[model samples]
Target chain A: MDRKNIKGFLEFVYDFYKSMKAHEITLVYEGEITHQITKAFTSLTESNMAKEEESNSVQKKVFHVMVECLQNISKHADSFGSDDFLFAGRGIFMVSRGDLEYHVTTGNVIENSKIEELSKILDHINSLDKEGLKQLYKTQMREGRLSEKGGAGLGFIDIARKTGRKLEYHFLPIDEDTHFFVLTSTISRNE
Target chain B: METIKIMGTDDTPTVILDAQNEIFEISGRSLPEDVTAFYDPILQWLDEYSSSPNPKTIFTFKLVYFNTASSKLLLDILMKLEQLHEAGNNVVVHWYYPEDDEDMQEAGEEYADIVDVPFEQIGYTLS
Candidate 1:
């Protein structure tokens, strides 16, 4: 491996290990990578059963959340771009399993101009609880700006409400015109 | 102007909305690759359906599962129905959840609180 690539890899591993101090099972997908996320999703879910069978509700919610988070990576992947600088937009999707909760995090490079809008949406969704989320979601649907692409921006809020957890996020500056968007959410199995 | 039908899958729901019949049904799970594309037609169909007065509009949403994006579209559908109801059309939303799934039941109630129409949450045992 080239020195630069090796350095980046080591740094990523170090950061991931530091962040997930207590997780036993950690799956990390980096760069322009692809996999059957569903298989990993199903296996991690099945591992939850030590011997006793768990409810289908738990399985469904976990699966739903996993797929939703992974789809963000697929949706934002910039493939076939001529600019090598745009190569960093490849993204990373990671899932970490702890004894009591599951942590799902995804990071993708996005346009710097979109950072404000993304932050606003995250802040708005985080500001609401289940009831408030539903209300705000409805209101947005009624009056929010719909892109010609047809997105009204309620995906993050739904994640928060459905998982019954806070939607955590961070924006790490990558360059002049782009930033790495990292979103993390937790689902408690004990609940 | 026409009905939109999307077959169900293990990961996604079956979107069955017929503008002509004024019967909208979303069943099964929802985790489509692209949320916007998957839901646009359904939203468009509902929008067109709302323009003309349909005597009875029944929205049956029995989603075993749905991701965050699908939740957004679900709200969109409900709001469109609310607009229709406000205009004095007959609109009712039947929200079905698996028995013992309090999360789904709570989700329905939350939607009920937002929209004007009555949302009846029905539960059926999987067994």
Candidate 2:
């Protein structure tokens, strides 16, 4: 612990605290995503929202959106170029509260080959209106087959339908085989 | 057949499906990490019950919150009742929701629209 390095670390910590406070972020975690982990995050967020005096319906919406976002990472973690220990089984999850809505943001790695297909799914969901999303949701549930991992590919549509807001996302290319996918789902707080 | 009564946790719902005592209900939150595995028994129970169901089966769903995965499982359960109804059984579903919760109410309506089972959406206060 050199004096100069210790001083820099404290400054970094202080800066992070300030940024988090400014954003009104309720929870943040960067690690592996699992069922147990999702349960913990959602439970903690539920408590936090309760403290904020949110209505029961808004609390339900936020809780639902958070579960979907976290579960997506655990269920859909890409296996490309993940041999690197740092990249394998790692993800970033955060929840922030604003005046009009609560935001659930997640970041994870994805195979390059899956980018186009994934993009199309998100785009298609975002392109539709309320009724359209409802139709798609029913159709997907009735006809869609569960993946090898048991996901019926209904998370996004359900989130979109519940929140009544467009999903915001983008992929940052890390190399040729993998990209960092970041998604943010907003739940309006009018309740 | 033995009844299925599993206590609900923060993630899983409390399920009560006892045929002998005239009680059949599923309530509370549901978001198990493994939906297929957790719901397999319930589905199986419904399957077996369909074969030798009570003359008049009145199942109830009092789910407070459930994920999309569980949504599919709910449809499966409702379809079982629908099949029972089609096979000369009087099956009615009472989808219960908190009085002020539109999402839960609408959820019941959606299921009612898709399935042929007689549905009665009942709104009650959360005591």
Residue by residue across A63-131, what tens digits does model 1's lDDT show?
666766666565554433356644632678777767677777888878877778878878877777777
lDDT, candidate 1, B1-127, per-residue tens: 6777888976668887776766689999875655667777777777777788568888899987776556666787888889999999988899999898887887798788877896788999877
Q: Give TM per candidate.
A: 0.72, 0.95
* TM-score of only chain B in every candidate structure: 0.92, 0.97
Docking class of 2: medium
lDDT (tens digit, per residue) of candidate 2 on A1-191: 79999999999999999999999887899978888898888888888778888989899888888888887888887654435544455689999998998889999999898999999999999999998988888888777766766687789998998898899999999888789999998888995
- Output the number of the TM-score-best candidate: 2
- Residue B62, candidate 2: Cα error in Å is 0.2
Pairs clashing within candidate 2? none
Q: What is the C-alpha RMSD of each candidate to the true structure, in Å?
A: 5.2, 1.6
lDDT of 2 at A41: 85
**Stretches of candidate 1 exceeding 4 Å from the true structure:** A1-22, A32-57, A75-85, A111-134, A146-150, A173-179, B1-6, B16-24, B35-55, B83-88
